[model samples]
Target: MNEADFAALRGAILALPYVRMLGFDIAREDGVLRGQLPFAERLIGNPLVPALHGGVVAALLHFTAAAQVMREARMARLPRVFTCTIEYLASPDLRDSYASASIVTRTRRFANVRVSAWQPHSGKTIAAATMQFLTGQMD
Candidate 1:
């Protein structure tokens, strides 16, 4: 995604009540679809480790992948998630989070997307996901 498209997607998605409450943000850098989650106390699952909830991390990955598919397909409606497999590489810290996604492959009706999430640095990915979506048949 480019800056203009990214801005539009970011605006639309960010305006959602849930997304806004959670402080979710979408960014584009170097034509990559990126998602961010600002840390909140309610988001912490393991207070002992101060780790973010697994569901939170997974959400970022899911949104990033879907956003990429949406941009690439230029869909009029949101794509439907068929399957999503997430790998937890490490526990996330109680801080801001980030993720990036790309479309691995796509047909007229189906799309495969890959996503990676990290806290401090891109190389230090804390989670990754491979997702398949139904890009067609919105009707």
Candidate 2:
């Protein structure tokens, strides 16, 4: 997706209370859909203590994958998560996290996507996920 498409999707997401509450802004672009996450001070973590919550990380991953599907399909709508799974590889440090996702495969009925989150300073993977999204009927 181009900047215009990203801007449109970003606007829709920003309008949501939950997304707004998370304080996420579009950080980078891969195409139409981009990645975002909470950058709040409370999102920071300690090496030996509670790190970024798994649920939060999962949310980012889920959003990333769903965003990709919505953008690539060019269906003029946001896709919802049918299901997703996140495997925590490492904890994110106290820095702005990074996230990205791409369409790995797609079929007439289903699309597969891969998403990842990381701590930029440490280059540690906070989470990785693969998800299946139902694009719904286009016609």
Best model number under lDDT: 1
Residues 29-76, candidate 1: write the lDDT tens digits. Answer: 776667889999999988998899898888888877877887889864
How displaced is residue 18 in candidate 2, in Å?
1.1
Worst 10 residues of 2 by lDDT: 25-34
Model 2: how far residue 51 lies from native, Å: 1.3
Give the clashing residue pairs of candidate 2, or none: 1-31, 1-32
Candidate lDDT values, in order: 0.83, 0.71
lDDT by residue for model 2 over 1-139, one digit each (tens)? 5678777766765666766776665655433345767467556444467576666677778766766676677645557666787889986655566678888888776788999988777867888998888887556
Root-mean-square deviation of each candidate, in angstroms? Answer: 2.1, 2.9
Off by over 4 Å in 1: 1-4, 121-123
